[model samples]
Target: MAIALNTKLAEGVQKAAAEAGLAVVNGQESAGFNGIPTEKYTLALVSAPEGHTFTLELSAGFDITAANIAPAVRAYLLESAKRLTNPRPDVFVTLGGLPVSFTNWQWPFHLSVSGADTYVVHGGATLEDGKTAADQYLKAKVSASMTVTFAEVVAAPEQPFAEGFIYNAVRKILDQGQMELTKSGGNRQVVPVTTRYYSAKQGKFIFNDTTAQQRADYLLSKIYWLSGVLGGGAPVWIADPRDAQYLNTTVEELKKTAESLAGEGILKLDPKFEYASSTEPLMAHHAEYEHHLQDALDFTRPTFNEEMRAGHTNM
Candidate 1:
């Protein structure tokens, strides 16, 4: 049987993409999404002028027929474009300064088998230590659970609503040393999605409480790893939603911060001022950034009780 395109979703996505300076060059129907058997519509989007391309996987389960969905889709597409302007759109940094890339994430939350009154999504993340060999990198299976209460307020259990917070939650867990990313034989890591992460009054997700200086430091580090090192000095998008959410601020604030950095000659903004690249002065602090990376790696390393390891304790 041939699967028909969801016209509602396609129209919404096309309109949103166009307004975001992107184009839906093509779309295809899939038998499943992230291995779960269900119809999926994956759109291939291209950013004009630069021609950078990325894919967005949308599940058929979204309530696209709803009138309110249009605005949500538009917002998501804009943020999605901003994220792709990153040299490594899939990678995000932890509070510990470690960069992790979450990939192959499943879409549309599934009911919990344990009947815990929650919905769950599954994915995988890898420690992206550019300095380390690929085979030596640490990896983890990620699952995030959203409480039924929290889920009710969500517009949809789609990428837009869940991805940002889920990524932030993973960073929080890694920073707190609650989750382990191992080189081999790792178990699933769960990120609890609770009401604490959302603000009903504000109607948005709140992850971190950061200051201007902290935000500046984060941008600097982001450029260091994502642009200076991995991207070969390519300009990266400054107004990223993921970063804004992680820092607990607005995209406008981040743009203002980027402008400030540009004025100091620490960064060079593109002609459009939408993207930023590291300057000589910024890259000059390579040693400092490297130290921070090493510190983060040390912080996330698993610690064992020496006495227990020596068989000196009984439970």
Candidate 2:
């Protein structure tokens, strides 16, 4: 059977991958991200020849090409494996969400006491008593000095980002961005985490802290109010499909489930990257590179799931 996939799924997968790429570009860690950055994620397409039905599913923890993909994808996969050459029933696809895994946190802390006085200088007391006998100008002074000490607590950012939701939102943004690319070349390139640190201890802080903060703020701006302009973090735009309460289980499990469909022969996993860029934010344009990479994601994306699961609502 010739099936048409939903563009939303492709949109979700692509957005997620691009965001992953963004994390590496910004010199942030992507691995500890609850498996969103892992290579285990998968997308599957399954076929059911006997029933003349097709299925598409996303696995939780395994690769889409592996033998443990989701049930629906398995059906379509087997169907594709069978002898069906009329319309050449196999199709390739991808999707995305957003890019920035975490938003910009101001993380305000007092680096200096009133900031001006980073040090204290001890001043010796001046002696002013003179001419004690006949006519004298009386003056008394205490020989006391002042000592300066510095104190500050370790300061860092704390995020309230919902782990699964953040990933899901980014996936959607990237998936939408993917539709604009040509398979040959020109992808959203992410800077490696090895690039540079924007934090204060780098000693580079004296000159660039403001600049770094500005850059961080700029990228965050794109995801925030602007996201409303594009539709982000919304209940309808930011829920991960792996919600067992809503779907069946966790994304990790779903990934494995999605991967098994490949054994059944219909699913395919594409190692792809999503790159985000905007003409605005003159500062972010210069921070990471010549332009601002709003966010990026790398994933074993689901392309056919876009086709089969077209009826469901995205969040």
Candidate 3:
């Protein structure tokens, strides 16, 4: 899989200097290509191959724009070029975002590619959160990359937090199902089952078959048709969204916490929903959870309890 690294990428030193209204010390641009130039005249008869080289060196107290940079870059080097491994700087990243500025907006990022001849790669980083600045860049690799090394600095993009695909899809199905049900329901056990088949020669044995699928289809055709498919699994809906993590992070201590938090006079509470299914959709069952939680908290609200003051927690 090719993850494009074209976006608002900047050197740690350059970023800090620019934020402080200070100019970059001396910005230079370069491109590295990987693979052989077989079509050259020297390789006409045989499959002899060669690659080219280019470099941009700047003087002190200078800044270079990303646009003026060359389209082709050197990714793999020949004997004439120098190769070195440098230090890894402390960096906060924000990847896969749109541009925010004209000057420091686009990055003069060095990139590598494979398969496709050339395509746009964009990226950036977050010093803090998704504010203040975004360093981005894009480049079409002169040749598809087998491996790459950024002589200067290569920016890592933002890692996804709430964008997990499988879990998100599961949650959507559950939430939509809850809307369809419109009624609060209790939790369902996620039973893992296997089929036992009769085998006279080998005795009865546990086996894998399409029985579960057939059952699911029967239910759908006789009762309700399935709206979608999540990978190979049948689409299912739930009435409780307090326990829905099919992706990202899931926990098993939610019920225990809910029971512990449930008290004498509270109705519904707003604790970190730490169920096994955070990716589950919001269900009508959760509406009652609110009431139960509020009652738990207000159980002693008339007397002003410290715990009822809404504690700050990061789960």
| Whole-model alpha-carbon lDDT for candidate 1 | 0.75
lDDT of 3 by residue, 84-142 (tens): 11011111111111111101112221233434332212221111111223232221111
Worst 10 contiguous positions by lDDT, candidate 3: 37-46
Q: Please, what is the TM-score per model?
A: 0.85, 0.17, 0.14
Candidate 1: pairs in clash = none
lDDT of 2: 0.24
Deviation of model 1 at 49, angstroms:
10
Q: Rank the candidates by TM-score, best first.
A: 1, 2, 3
| Residue-level error in angstroms, candidate 3, position 203 | 60
Compose the digit string of candidate 1's lDDT tens values, residues 1-315. 122555666666666677876776665555333355443433333634345455566675555446777676677777777766677877887756777888877777877778789888888888876787988888888888888878888877877666778888888778777777778828777889787878899987787788889888988888777788877898888777778888889888988898888999999877666788877899899888888877776676666776778789987
> Once superposed on the true structure, which residue ranges of model 3 sit more than 4 Å away at CA?
1-19, 32-89, 92-113, 117-315
Off by over 4 Å in 2: 1-184, 187-192, 198-220, 223-226, 232-315
Candidate 2 lDDT over 127-190, as tens digits, reads: 1111123233211111111112211211110111112222232233234443222223134222
